[model samples]
Target: MKAFQFVEWQRPGEVRDVPVPEPGPGEVLVKVGGAGACHSDLHLLELPAGSRSFAPPFTLGHENAGWVERLGPGATGFEPGDAVIVYGPWGCGLCMNCRQGMENYCQVPGLPSPGGLGGTDGGMAEFLLVPSTRYLIPLGDLDPREAAPLTDAGLTSYHAVKRSVHLLGPGSTAVVIGAGGLGQMAIQVLKALAGATTVVAVDVSADRLQVAEDVGADETLISGDHAVTAIRAITGGLGAELVLDLVGVTSTLTMAAQMARVLGHLTIVGVGTASLPVSFGSPPYECAVASPFWGTIPELIEVIALANSGKIRMLVEHFGLDDAADAYQMLHDGRIRGRAVITPHD
Candidate 1:
């Protein structure tokens, strides 16, 4: 089988030949239907050697969906040929968090997690070996090819939006920063789940802001020095009650805090390493800030349900396995309009 992998640290991943993996006891093997190309993959490639908990030479697709090729012994609840989405974060299944489906916050120490980006092999190849059948969510009637991005891009945004939904109500305002793949879904999730009458989307890209508009943002703004001012003006100087910073950089984090109302919530979901110093005078009084990692398996199920019902849609561009490098290049250059999915069998 041909797989795209991060073969070396601080270098671009390569497409190389590798043997196909078979399902082991209590595991499941899935034929790769689609794999999302995430910005984190690019960031991983830029890190110094040994910086990541997971070493190199592993397939890199975290957002994955596919059909069951085979089920190992004792794998129940799903049969072969079922369409499913692979939950990206694989944690030790025995922890309290994992027992509650919050595997993203797995607490077991000194154990490497599974799945792409988590140290285990991912779904970028012809087939993927899922450690347990529990990580597979039934896709129902959704197309596995187009449904891959729901695993991360959709689930992450949904998790963030779900947490702060209390702040969004009649006459409330919600601001979404970095209107890219995750941000677009965040916009729609806010409109559908949050009762906020005013939904604002901010992004550096005019194209992405346009996508925000198309996906239900009531207002779109080009992110810059003036973004905070524009948001305040739109909100009658009260600022937004909820600010979801999908791009967790210094500027966006600063803007999110400045644009949030007192006692509001600001959730950082992006992977940028920029730091924000919280103090008495930095962010507004009583405002709460938090950084959430990838969502839990239950959230992924809800995201898939939302996608299945057509309330949320993912805009994706397709690429074959051979063209996976070009796909990553396009993502790195900011040319991809939405999420990019690599179709291994195409």
Candidate 2:
């Protein structure tokens, strides 16, 4: 079997022939069909060499969907040849957070955090060995390529929007910054689930803003020349009730804080790294700033259902596993509009 292996930090992944893994007890082996190249993967590759999270010689594609090749002992309720979506985040099952279905927040010590791909052998290979059967969700009638992005890009957006749906009631507003893959999906999720009266999308790229408009943004703004002011203007000076900043840079976070109403919520879903200055002073209103990771297992199921029911369309661009380096380059350059999905079998 051939797999795209990460050989070094800040370097292109190497495509090499490797032994296919067999599932252990309580595990399953999935024949990789489609794997979404996430923006976080770029951060993983860019991690300084020998850093704590920079583990090399491992395959790196976490947002995955494929068919079950074999099920190990104790892996019931699913059989071979069943199409499934791989939930990549795994944690200690006994933790409180994991018990509540929020495995992404598990508090167990020495346990694997919810970060896969870099931490574990992920889905960038012909066949992937899933650690636990619980992480595999069956995708009925959903194409692998279409459903792969929903695992992370769509799920993350859904979770972020779900946190502020109460504030997004009638006559409310939601501003989504950075209209990339996750940002565009956030726009759609806000329109479909939150019932946001007005959806303002901000992005530097005019083409991305246009894509946001096509996907249900009430208005779009270029992230320059007072982007927050434009968002406030669109909201009649009250600012948005829920500001979802998909780009977690200092500039975007500052804009989010400035463009939010009193008692509003600002959710950061992107992994953009930037130092933000904080000072104690008179603030406009009470606002909550939070970073929402990928969603829970049930939310993943719900997202899959929405995609299957034709409620939320999956915007994707297909690429072969050999294009892993090019995919990351396009993502870093912001050249790819939708999620770039890698097909290992292609």
Candidate 3:
């Protein structure tokens, strides 16, 4: 079978023929359906080898959905031909967080925390071997190709927004920075769950902002010198009660902090390496700032439920396995409007 692999550190991943994996006890094998091309993949390629705990030569995708092909011994609850979404995070099942279904915050040491994140070979292939059925969620009637991104793009946004949902009340405001794939998902999520909270979307790309509006954003603004003022004015100069920074660069972070209301929540969900030095007045007093990782298992189920209910859907551009590199290039150039999805099989 052919798979895209990060064969070396500080280099681009390539499609290569590899052995089709066989699932072991308690594991399951899934035929490749669709794999999301995330910006974090580009970041992983650019990052230095020594920066992470895992080395390369692993399959390169994390956001994935597919149909069950076979089950290893002792695997139950799902049968062959059932559609499923693979959870991105993989942690020691015995850990306290994993026991609570919060494997995103897996406390185990010395293993790849997320299934496709590091050392774990991911779903960018003809087949993926999931270590446990715990990482697989039934997709029901949803198309695996279209629903693949819910594993990461959708789940991550849900986690970030759900954490700060308490601040989103009727007539209150929430700001979403970077209206790309994850940001667009955040917009729909806020609309579905935030209830009557003004959902504002910001991005440098006017085209992407337009998509945000089509999805659910109540207001859209271009990220620039006046971005802060626009957000303030939209919230009646009180600033937004919740700010989600999907773009974690310095400038966006600065604008995010400025747009945050006092006693608000600012959550950074991007993978950018930029850092912000907090001070007395930067984020306002009583503001709670945090960088949340991917969603919990229960949250992932909820995200899938939202998708299944037609409340949220990912706008995806499909690519065959051979064109996966082109998909990555387009995503890196910011040419893809929404999520870039690679269909490893027909």
Candidate 4:
């Protein structure tokens, strides 16, 4: 089987022929349909060895969905050909958060992420070995290829937006910073659930903003000197009721703080390792700041529901496993307008 793997620290990942893996007890093997190329993997490659938890020598595709090839001993309920989306972030199943299906927030310490992001071989190959059947969600009517990004890009945005949904009511405003893959999904998630609230998207690239507009953003602004003022002006000087800073750098965080209304919510969703300074009267009065990890299993189900109902869809550019390197390069160069999914079997 040909798999794209991260073989070393600070080096670009490469495609390799690796042996197909078999499922163990309670495990399942999925014939890889599609795998998302996430930005976090780019961040990982830029970091020095040991700076992050996960190591290389593993296939690198966390956002995954495909058909069940076979089930190991003790695995049940799902048939051999059932199409399913994988829930990443494997965790100790007994933790309190895991019990509630929020495995991303599991209490166990130093737990490695599942294949692609950690020690396990991920879906970049023709097949992936899921630790358990519990991590698999039936894709229903959604195509596993287009639906693959719903596992991470879609789920992460859903998690980020779901937190501050209470603040987004009729006549409220919500600003999304960064119109990349996750950010694009965030915009759609807000539209599907945030009801009547105006959605504004901010990105440095005009092309990205155009994509944002095409998707559903009520307003699109370039992130520049006037962005803060523009957001306030659009909000009638009140500022947005909810601000989702998907970029999370110093500049975007500062702008997010400035665009947030009193008693609003500011949620940081990106992995841009920058800090936000906090002080009295900073970020307005009574504003809440939160950073959430990937969403729960239940929220993934909701995102799937939204897709199934035609309320949302992943704008995807397809890549074969052989062109996986080029896909990563395009993602790092910010050339992809929305999500990029690699179809290994194609």
Candidate 5:
């Protein structure tokens, strides 16, 4: 079986042949239907060696959906040939957070994080071995190939928007920074789930901003030094009631802080490592800033339901497993308009 693996730090990932994994006791093996290529994978490879808890030689696709190939002894509730989406975050399943289905914030000690993000083996392979049946969510009528990105890009954006939904009301404004894969979904999610009448999308690329407009952004702005001012103007000087920063760099974070209204919600969902200084008199008055990791299982289910209902649509480009490296290159170069899904059997 061919697998795309991150074998070395600060080096490009490679495709190599590996043995197909069989499901062990209490585990399940899934035939890879599709695996999403995410921007965070580039950040993961840029970090210095030993920066993350999990090492290389692990598969690298976190957003995954596939069919059940086989189930191990005692792995119940699902049968072979069942279509499911792999919940990327693998947790201890015993902690309070995990018990509540927010395993992305698992508090257990000495456990690796989610799959593909410095954790266990992921789905960028011919087959994936899921540790337990708890992580598998029914795909329903959604095509796994088109549904892969929903696990992360869709679910993560849904989680962030759900958090700040209280601030989004009729005539209120919601700002989305970075109109890439997640940003595109965030725009649609805001339209589908929130009451905000005005949704603004910001990005460095005019093409991406156009995509944002296509997805339902009431307005689009070229992100730059004047972005904050434009957002203020759009909100009639009150600033946006809710701002989602999908690009977490210093400049974007600064713009997010400036664009958020006093007492508004600023949610950071990108993996950018830029640090923002916070002290007395810093940031907007009473503005709440939060950085959520990923979505919960329940949230993932909701995201899938939204997709199944056609309320939200995912724009994706398909690539074969052999072209995974090229897909990553396009993602790093910002050439992809939306999410890229790797189809192993394509």
Candidate 6:
């Protein structure tokens, strides 16, 4: 099996031949069909030695979609050759969060907290071993490349938008910042699920803003000092009721706060490492700020259904497993307009 691994931090990933993983009890082995390169993967590779959760020599692609190659004991309802999407979050099957179908937030007895490619050997190879059968969700008749991004970028946006849906009324507005992979998905999710009359997207790149508009954003703003003011003007001085910051940097988070109406919600969904200093302002209206993790399994199912129904469209570029470094560089350089997928079959 060929895999791309992190031999060291702040260095290029290495492509090597490793032993193919086998399914253990209650586990399944998936032949990698497609794995999306997430921004977090780029960040993990750039981590300055001591800040990373997982060390070197780990396979690092999490957003996985493939066919079941082998199934272990007690892995019922799925058999070899069955098309499936890996849920990516591994957790205890009996925990409270897992019981509620929120395995992404699992924190319970006898199980470690769920972490995807960052914590375990992921699917940037010919074969991926799913630690639990519960993480497998069947993808009926959908292309694996399209389903790959839904595991993380799509689900993360879905969860972030779901939080402030009530605020995005017919007359209300929303502003999505940094129109990258997650930002592009956020626009589609806001249009499909939240009925915001005004969907404004902000980014430094015109191409990304164009992608955002093509998806469903009512307007796009080139991010800068004028971005927040532009959003406020579009909302008729009240500003948007929900502002999603997909860039999580200090500037974008500050702009989100500046563009949100009093009593509005600002959802931070990006993985950038910048910090924001929060303070009370004049005529404060109970502003709520939060950071959302990858969504629950049921939410992933809903997102898949949304894609299956043709409501959400995925824009992807395919790369071979050997070109993992190029894929990472494309993402780092903002050269990818949408999601970049690695197909192990190559």
Global lDDT scores for all candidate models: 0.89, 0.82, 0.90, 0.90, 0.90, 0.84
For 1-346, candidate 3 gives per-residue lDDT tens digits of: 9999888877878999999999999999999799999998898888887878788888988998999999999999999999999998888888888899988888877643665577789889999999999999999789999999999999999999888888887889999999999999999999999878999899999999999999989899999769899988888888999999998999889989999989999899987879877999879888999999888899989998999999999999999888888898899999998999989987
TM-score of 3: 0.98
Clashes of each: 0, 0, 0, 0, 0, 0
lDDT of 5 by residue, 1-346 (tens): 9999999999988999989998899999999899999988998988899997678888889999999999999999998889999888888899999999988888887653777776577899989999999999999999999999999999999999998888887989999999999999999999998845689999999999999999999999998868888888878898998899999999899888888888998889988889766655456789888999888999999998999899998999999988999999999999999999999977
Question: Which pairs clash in model 1?
Answer: none
In angstroms, the error of model 2 at 296 is 0.8
When 2 and 5 are scored with TM-score, the better candidate is: 5
Q: Which segments of model 3 are wrong by more than 4 Å? A: none
- Give a tens-digit lDDT track for model 1, residues 100-171: 999888898744264778667888999999999889999989988899999999999999989988778888
lDDT of 2 by residue, 197-316 (tens): 788899889999999999998888888648877877777888888888888887787787788777888788878887444445312546777787788888898888878887787688
For model 5, what is the error of residue 89's alpha carbon versus the real structure, in angstroms, after optimal superposition? Answer: 0.9
Candidate 1 error regions (>4 Å)? 110-114
By the lDDT metric, which is better: model 2 or model 5? 5
Candidate 2: minimum summed lDDT over ten consecutive residues — where? 275-284
Q: Estimate the TM-score for candidate 5.
A: 0.97
What would the TM-score be for candidate 6 when compared with the true structure? Answer: 0.96
TM-score comparison, 3 vs 6, better candidate: 3
Q: List the residue pairs that clash in candidate 3.
A: none
Worst 10 residues of 4 by lDDT: 110-119
Query: Candidate 3's C-alpha lDDT?
Result: 0.90
Residue 22 CA displacement from its true place in model 4, Å: 1.0
Instruction: Assess candidate 5 and give its lDDT.
Output: 0.90
